[model samples]
Target: MSQFSFLQSEFAPVYEHALKAESAALSDPRAACFYARLALETAVKWMYERDRALKSPYDTALSALIHEPSFRNVVGNALVTKARIIKDHGNRAVHDTRPVAQQAAVTALRELFHFSYWLVRTYAKGAKPEAGLQFSADALPKTAQVEATTLARLQALAKSFEEKTKAHEQAEAARLQTEQARAQLEAEIKLLQDEIAAVKKANQAAPDTHNYNEEQTRDAFIDLLLHEAGWPLDQARDREYPVRGMPNNAGEGFVDYVLWGDDGKPLALVEAKRTKRDARVGQQQAKLYADCLEKEFGRRPVIFYSNGYEHWIWDDAGYPPRGVQGFLKKDELMLLHQRRTGRKSLSATDVDSTIVERFYQTRAIRRIGEAFENDNQRKALLVMATGSGKTRTVIALIDQLMRANWVKRALFLADRVALVNQAAGAFKTHLPHVAPVNLITDRQAEGRVYVSTYPTMVGLIDDVQNGVRRFGPGHFDLIVIDEAHRSVYRKYRAIFEYFDSFLVGLTATPKDEVDRDTYSLFDLERGVPTDSYELDEAVTDGFLVPPKAVSVPLKFQREGIKYDDLSDDEKEAWDALEWSDDGQIPDRVDASAVNKWLFNADTVDKVL
Candidate 1:
């Protein structure tokens, strides 16, 4: 006989279906729940037949069967409660359109199993019921108790999922509402643009001229360029932007207008002129304002200056300031900001490698150039041992930066006149196309490439500090320091601080005790150069000869010797030397006496 034979022929269908439900529980819990529901209904019907007085209508719900007094009195409230729970879950399984939750189904099935076990024991002819039986967890097997707890935990998870889904739907609705509001704002802006265009057309057609003042011109530009260009003129931009830079004769300065980005930082600046005045009238003021804003924003922004009629855009990274028909679209301005800030690093392909002579030199140029591009670093340090060709490597890097359009004009500084001349020679020979001006004699700071002695640069910085402001902060796109370990320290540091250019320091010994300050000046980590060719590596690569240490012990005493130890001939010579009145050796002492007193012929021969 089967192990479930206690579920007799009348209850066989309930037992068979319960077995199928158990088989499907893991892989297909929905099917298992449906089958479990069927088993519960069958068990309830079997109980109903046993007590004919507890007659349930043919269409009676599973809850009614459990609540019937005849059935309840026989099975007890505990068993009836389990039967009711199964009835509710089973109805959901068959009638609800939503798929049954695994936990819900598993929980209902667990309760049904316990109820079926009780029914089989109570109703089967050969079965025996334990006295005072109850459907409490303490009476269940360990595995069944554990599974019941797991089902409860899963039910909690399902509830959490439902809550999260509801939150997501609410967030999505809010997003759509925001988009609709944005669309309405855009439409209003479009209407404002049309009104401005109509006004401009009407003004041109009218015989009476409209002489708009500076403020009126400013307002017109705000409506025509900013509003029409989709900038929205919201909290992000500011008029009469307060900035402090190169002081005037009165020692006060501020920008006229500044454009701000969403990040609450300055993006660009506009220097407005009266409708009748030339836009170039404000260029010098705009340049000073740009320098001042760099302190607050950490990057110099795109520059624009305009009278009411003409607009001009300037990018220090690319070509000179030129007239544009109108302001660029807002998206184009953002892209220009990204490019100006060097958000992406340059690749090897971006560099012009033709001037680089060797593989290692090329590698150094690529790495340091990429580092500069990556961070838009203001200062970079490169250490190559003497004879390792630092000048050539730096030239290659500068060439690459210029070719990539990262640098427009460059300045090279050195401590001595000879070093400056040497650097100029190298630049002329290697980069023949680049005009290398001598800043010392020529008094010229303007050139694609300018070689200058540190003292000459000092004079220029003094002029700027005294308010003559000979060179603007953006005068040089890049500055290279040769023998940087010496030139960038002490009183010479002002030259570096005055310009807002990218600084590159080249040294033969960066990690030496005296050069540590130089390393720190370039912002290099301790003992690390941005690009390094160590003495040992240079020798290993055969760029330099390996130095050998040879020790030769000297027999002669370094300290002064007593006159008593001198030989007879030396003593005679020393005695013959004439003394002054104060007992000092006479300035008229003969060469023969001096040489003989210092060393005998035999001693001189031995040293030689």
Candidate 2:
């Protein structure tokens, strides 16, 4: 008997996928994982279609659908986490080339079983599945001499199942053609909705009995992140790698994960901890593992410690430990290791004057370089007035950083699409050698420099492609915020927090003029910016023309029009005009109400 046999009666459409997932668990781990995710997706979509209480999300992607507020509210946090695991694993099974482990497939099946149980208990009108039922791997059918299928074949199989499911649903709907049958179905759906509501209320009051297994979740999350970073964990030496020279009696330890380079040297090592524990708790342990690897291989590997929620990277040979959003890719880690010995001093690098000729612009670049190179600060704020060549200045800064090997990829964010397009043009014009892509026009475009509006970038932050995020936390080495102000702080601050990159905020508004604490966003003190070129300075330097103010006065606007002061012709015209329904002309009109309530073309001509 299949572990998901309970779902066969009430959710036949979902049961098909669940049963296939169980059948392929041992024979084809990848297919099993893929089917588990398919089952969850089908079940969630089924609920959203039938449940009137659940609001449909604009995005139908599995990640977006499950993370939608209404879905999260119904399933709660624990179930949401389980759904995420299944979705992520299934995505990797289909999109990634690494072979899926049997253990991972088992994990996916267990999570799907619990998730299915919750769905059936809440929504099924027939016999509800028992909550005490457990998913037994031994009960899954063992197949001998199963045929190996390609990923493309698996996708085709899933597509076929979707077609069949659709046809079955249409046929079922055809049977309810009679008005009486349709009415009975509607009544049944209404009753089911009411029952679901009551169940939700009761579940809210009851204590949660689900075993979260946070440690397992943490390891799975870390695995997903590493895979996204291009680490193929197919080799036996990739995980739980044994090492010697520990201080304990056994004089040995097993590293959580080891990332290897083509030259047979360890590029980096990761130490994973439980989700609730601080990642720093493994810092010393990670350092010790690095020491052992260095003693064995003659080269120290970059040490990274993570608890799934937070990650930290420490290149003990070069820089202090710093927080990162995810693991660095193999090429990125290799380049980082190379930079330790080959990096040039940024202070010694010259600013490309051809790109930014202004003295203040060059000075601003120098101050920013000093902050990063000497002060060890990761954020810098540049306050310059509009039309002061902020775009050109940043292009030059990026040029210098790239030339010095400080930045490999950079992202520039603007509040408006027009600004994104304008900045992209500026980068292309000045730094023609480097490729620049405007995310506003084409999100899939690849380039060394990415330009995007804040809102567009926010949506793309969590967007996963081919089981990996297109813009991982460590994707960009630097991020430039154009027109950085209170507006960015209010609606799109997540963009800055999500990426593990050096931040350089460019703002036209002065500190005192902005209502929110803009300085705090850049980690700078109030009234102090990393560099400033005010409007007065720009005008004094002849970069901008000074403004001239003039005041205009009109007769009726300056003084209220008094009936006593009006000429006989004007008074006759006023009397001819209707001021109110009561047909009463006022003795005088206020200056503020002259054009608002009463308009005279002759008075407007005088102002013009």
Candidate 3:
């Protein structure tokens, strides 16, 4: 009688988890949310295994799996959004200790039901399930016993399954009977793939009748986002809150959501619109709500508006509304409120001398500060040549910004792992109080400054846990790009666009040598960067030593070496070496091939 009963046949594996999720809805809400996500993940992994069209991603993390291009193409936008909601809520249920509501569990089950319906309709090999089948809450188990399991245990179980799969494959390779079993499994997978393709082709010819319930999905997603940011939403007054002094004839309107401070005054107000509508449509409406709250409490609250997919935060008295990936945490919002009156001038702040005592480095930091505070520029590029203390200069700049209360958190991105480690060490040594975290080694470590390679940061950019992203748009107050060049701009420009943070690009290459696109990324002219210190200047000022070139003359390098000219021991050694796979050796070696194809210890030592 379970709404997920249809999964018992072909999707038996998923059925067990889905049934548990459905049964636990009224009893253990957290387990219900977690199991629902597990069921969806199982089904999706099943599809990837059997369906030829769905290619696997390099990283098999659930977030990466669902967001993979091929997977998205197969599921479409509606199912993708559903998967996101289930995954997000499930993440929250496991990661957060706060009690999850029964309604959240119910919403997860409903979304899972629709997702299961799609899977069976598209992939079921035997006679397809009835199109008329509908999910009913009444069909869910009224009372049922559930197991107590932790997220760690579930993850270990998943890992065990993977190990077993590998072991089974190895056994199949060794024994003929097991090999035959694997062959049969492969054949079944092929048949299922064909069936999936046929079903999709047939579905294309028919009228679409599936109901996505986008409006409800949108509201659920927004709620999960708020929940992730530490909003309990337990009280009846949290949503559709009543307020006075609207511009309407009634002189009042219900605010969509109001986040309250401990004193009962409003911390912030959110105005939510339908998913399809522009989030900006609620901007003026949110302003009105803020005005009403300020009148009532004698304190102006920060305003936010969203359509589930897009979110914006505006401290109207100080700054314009800007799009954000998610809502800020309570402490972050409180800090924002405090900063309205307490923030000091960034341009007036003195650069830390202990971090960077060089004259050019300090000047570069001052120029960047002016670009940010005076010019109101969001991005700045520093073109300092190699060995010119680019890393230390930025470290000093971050110290200044942090002291002036302009930045709370910062991210330093490097293109190479070695560079990430190197920069992290510099930051730790100079700004020890900030506590830098190297994401390359330990991603879960928490700190004020985060350091990562470009690829590592790209993988982490979309990571959401308990309905909140690990690296939201507003997560970092500043993002520093190391070795900013053409490759970074071409391959990882999305990282810059995704985080709504002040940016600083550091490069050893001069402006003229650097790519035009890299300059454009920092909103600078092709030959004019925010600041520059050429290698020639550094050398002239005695900050860096000029390179010295020396030429060494070697007999073998200048002329070719003939086999007959070698001494007895040298000839024996040459004959012993393998010149090619066929064991053939040339009669003579060319001058260009002295170091390229031939190596002599005595000659190399002499040259050195």
Candidate 4:
């Protein structure tokens, strides 16, 4: 291979000139010296560009470049001195118009070869450089393959860049179109604000007038907003429809207006009241009718209340009522329903039954999974004793949940690192084919199942709070907090609220303070367990060994002294033997007094 092949693309020109200088040394010393100077200039320029700190725009002197700290650090004094000698000799050949001696040219070529070798070793990384480089014409690259290969690579890069630029231009065009649409929407909002301001000004000027006809005002407001929202209000609405489940207090309470979808079923209920009443005044009545309508129909309709001048909308899906300028279109209401209900709809029957499960574990999974179906609850606690195979049971639960598609990702948290690692190991043992992610050292918790210590989660929470890392509240579908009693506390409470996922807390010590806090977190009543596999039941079922307590008594201190048993003088002496605040007798107590008044030394020694 050619010596130039060892150098990188950036140093290719220097390599080429050095090789040429070596070749021309004997036949033409002046030409050889000129090429050597070109080679040094190219090398210095490469070094300057590699470290931008070395670039001196004001000074272009070659001597100044050789003296630079960056250059000297890399090349060292020996190489720098040799470079100077070569530069001086090359300058004489070029400026003086004089021919250099064969010896001088050969020496310059040798030094240039050494510099090339050093550059290649430092920067080329993998290529091998010739150690015994000499002034030989035969060593120069004579083939055209290198030039052809470089040209082809450059052409490919240009094509790649052109494609990227076209894609960028398309994205820019789409962004501009979106910006224009936003600007138009902003203009419309401004117009609405101006109209509301004018009405407020008129109302303030004539507060006691109240001369507007309520029916006409209601019809006018509804008509204007419906037209703006692209709804045919006249055809889309049914007037005076009797609610199916509502009490007939006023001859079958009639709904003001029920908006229908394309399928001729109710999509929303709009309770229109007189302009004198507030919009919120109709909220309760609207909610009552919505419940009645939902019972009659399979799905609940969007609840809306309007007092002609203002309108508000409410959905039973936990979102509170909010005032809007206009009603939601039929299509918009359907989209909202889909988003709220279709988010996490997984059936228990979808679980894979091929995997084995303990009887207690199966029961726990059934109960907890059913509870997940309840819309009112989002958290639960599994109270299983320490040796009752909680980790194995949770792994089985996770497996079923994964199969049923209830949880796409889950976080397994523990207070201690060892417990977290143990849990991770249990998962690997049960699902040997699946790999678990370790969040403690990985900087990120990835994969379907993530295992982490509570401290690591705190760090992640800190990062998210400071805006250094961005993890959405709903990133994880489920969070299983192991030893939940210890993990959920005042200092780390934010970790629970930051995630909008279903929580399952597992703990052995779920009583007293822990039990109260756990219940409060899950919003459960006293003495109600979300899922319980108690120690007694586990022992009875042959799942754990029965625990036994042993008591031991000391012979010497079998019967300790009592204050009531002492004589009046002994009691006085004992009381006078003053002790510390902690109720420990002072060391200053007389030994003879202790032997005579207090217990014997043997008893005292045994107690100590």
Candidate 5:
């Protein structure tokens, strides 16, 4: 019932302070004040390190603590005698009628180790002994009864702490196991990257020079990704995951599957392409999706374009190599041929003007859609490539939710203005039947799919939680954070934890090697789903176009351009870039060193 209990966990600082007090009373004043400080420091040192809680009796060094005046008064003579027994030996050796030899100090140090052991056996892990110098429970006299009660209470506390220790150990073990699994996954991914590099090394394949329509290729590539790296298909080929549209204009648009995890929210408009043909064309189609989609709920929709053969992933945020990608080295790699295929490159006109679609379902899309529609409390992050009809797939989801009446209201968020503007336009164009649509922003808050920027949400959370002047609770029933990769921060996390919004996030690139903060958010928010079929289904079904990788025998075509929008740390990286003997990157470049580098038009302007 105490205020402090509600405010914070009490165990951390209490034990530390008590141990400090105990040490100060035990150190001998005979040595310099330095020795006293040393004793106190040593006693408390175990606090910084792990002290095994042994069940056996600690007979020696513990003597100092138990025999001290304060300890004797608190405990009893029996405990004091145990401590004194060992102290007596050291005393004899040091105080004997002979010069104190090197052996005396060595012997004292040995006794100190025993004291350290006792420290671990006792206070270190809260290990309780059967009996110790304690207040006797016997109601024989005033002092005895008081002593007994004190010991009884201490015994109970010790017992409670032991249980807590066991729980702590189990939690730690689970965490370590999770970490190990992650490490193993990273290693496997690295191996796969090496394999891809080896394959690309065989021949330098040039970029596709094609004059083609969008649909066939997008479907082809999606199939490729699914076939190569997605999961198996169900016997029914999975029934339709219905897309429902809410009447509230705020809740417009139909959607397919939405995958939720601790990672944030992702909405997927999934569709599996049959992996029957070459996957090259599919990739191009998926890439085009980026041009059409808009931002939603301050995040971007990730396009997972995979057929049963190859996977071509894209994100509304313009990030590539999304799901499972590895850097393939080119020296031994087959360089992408610089051949000029008579085929012409794609023009903007060739790309689909409509990024967000209403309804399109393949077995893969249906399965994912079903998952989302059926999922009760999970928040999802949907990934697909640019040209792939992620919008269309998500539309089905919206329609399904409305039809089910599961959603009272929904919020659509996105990563950027141009991107979300596409999402907003989609609602206006397709779901016009739904009335009273609202758009949420720093300045405006209306709409079922509340679209805004990640920074805006983070800022709003700060306003709500800290003593900021603005903010009301329960902003939305379902919060969809678009461009989730860019929106993770302390404030964003605070809002999610502080409110009860059914959140769903979407992105093309689910994982990024850079900006670990995004992954950290994923771990904290979504405890990695047990059923994940990204790599397999895409490969088996021909949705995403498989790569015809041509690793150029070059380091890189200049580490592309660093985007103007960057976090604080990224800006620091930008400010420090150095070139090698030719155009390759160097290891380090400080501010002063960067200024020294001469720039010429012939040289690449940006650093990796």
Candidate 6:
């Protein structure tokens, strides 16, 4: 049964001290009769609510208990026996006109002490909520105030939780209502946009320099949208697109604009929102219409809707909705236009920040190339934020290496063991190789320009002890490490230094005081010929990926885990760790450690 844990913070001390006091002062000739009477009173309370009708009142306490229903609450036969004995003791001392012996009284007090002890033990063992929590049963006047405080606190917390839940439900309802309204407005906006577009297209197809109006502007925009979207605007005007449906495939659904791209044979279904707020907006409706038109034309139409005013684009219909994009006028487009959505030309500063600027103004390509100038020490470490394009960084580096041939062998190492294998596998897929690439695992330990676990080579020292081990030092030109703050990161440092290889470590987390050894790789102050290098140049050059730093705070129910200051047992384990003849721990020590023989009787099972 599930147990509700009561804190030792409140009731335990009172229980302990009260039991001690009772143990001390409660022993006297008269006390035996008092206890007996108390026991009889309890047994009688059981009689009033007869869940199981008793066969006879005179029956032994065992008979009454065994026949009782709530075995969980009352301890059946055993408790009944205790009650009977106490009643007998009371009769012998109090009512029989006999002087109670001191020993008899002391024995009775001792029994009371044991009963309290039993209650404590049962509580400590934990019990079900259905059984109810027992606290302050023997409460003194002094302790009642504190118990009341604890109860009050619990009540407040429950009330707070209920209030928060109710507030959240109300907020969610409001949000849902808001979303429905926005969708309705967006659809109305789309309809106005579509009508305007059809008008412009008619004028364009008509080949007349007609008087321009809102209708003409709309038609022009639709025609231009179709052309750019890769749909043949001329063909679309004549209803040339094909249509199909899923459940009912009788050409029920038509496609909009379907176009061929250099790669994706890319198809887009568009919904246009002409304005942010509009009545009866079915902008998506027109986009959907175009999508259907494309399907009818035997191609998936890249759908688009534009009001020549408000521009909202969706790639597909399935959404919250999804593929939602708002119109943002670029510097080229904003040279003259002025509105909340359209602004003046992008300033020189903004241009410098753009990705295109890195190629020209900042000489980003040149900066990357210069970092690789040194044959050995030219290894680079770039710190980019979370959203920063690390993939693009790797791609650019690969591109440089492939073109220049300054380096022969390249190995990319992700900080995670899982990522190491993943990256290597992904690399194999991305590149064309005449010879199969090697990544060491349990099955195979050797390969050209291998990617593998740091321990893969060291793990087999047992078999190697009797013979010569094959994998000594990898013959790679460059080794890059990702997520370098991990526990295994120190091992990589050892590899680059002792094994005489150029190293580059990459991480989303910057080096901090907590990880000094990790920071040693990218020593900022001295900037010596150490195995590490940090780049501020990439950011200056606009070549570095701009990252977003998002800090998500977590609140644990209790404080987070805090290990105690190192214990003697922990110190002993540290001292015991040693290399064997095989360069790994001896098998005996391994087995012993696995069993947790480091501590006590059950140590062996834990050591592993």
* Clashes per candidate (backbone, < 3 Å): 0, 0, 1, 0, 156, 52
Candidate 4 weakest ten by summed lDDT: 462-471
Better of 4 and 6 by lDDT: 4
RMSD of 6: 35.4
TM-score of 3: 0.76
Q: Write the per-residue lDDT of candidate 4 for residues 482-575, one digit (tens) a residue.
A: 8876335544555676565678878887443455666777767755778888887888998899888998954324454556667899778877
Candidates in order have lDDT scores of: 0.63, 0.84, 0.83, 0.64, 0.36, 0.39
**What lDDT does candidate 4 reach at residue 456?**
75
Question: Candidates 3 and 6: which is better by lDDT?
Answer: 3
Per-model C-alpha RMSD: 38.9, 9.6, 7.1, 30.8, 29.3, 35.4
Distance from true location, Cα of 554 in model 5, Å: 9.8
lDDT of 1 by residue, 35-87 (tens): 67778877786556444345563224464466556677766545655665565
Residue pairs in collision within model 3 = 92-466
Candidate 4 has an lDDT of 0.64
TM-score of 5: 0.29
Q: Sorted on TM-score, highest at the top, how do the candidates line up?
A: 3, 2, 1, 4, 5, 6
Tell me how candidate 5 scores on lDDT.
0.36
- Model 3 alpha-carbon miss at residue 364, Å: 2.9
Best candidate per TM-score, number? 3
User: 350-448, model 2: which lDDT tens digit per residue?
Assistant: 999899989999999999999988888889999898989999999999999999998989999998888898998898899988799888889888888
- How many Å off is the CA of 504 in candidate 3? 2.5
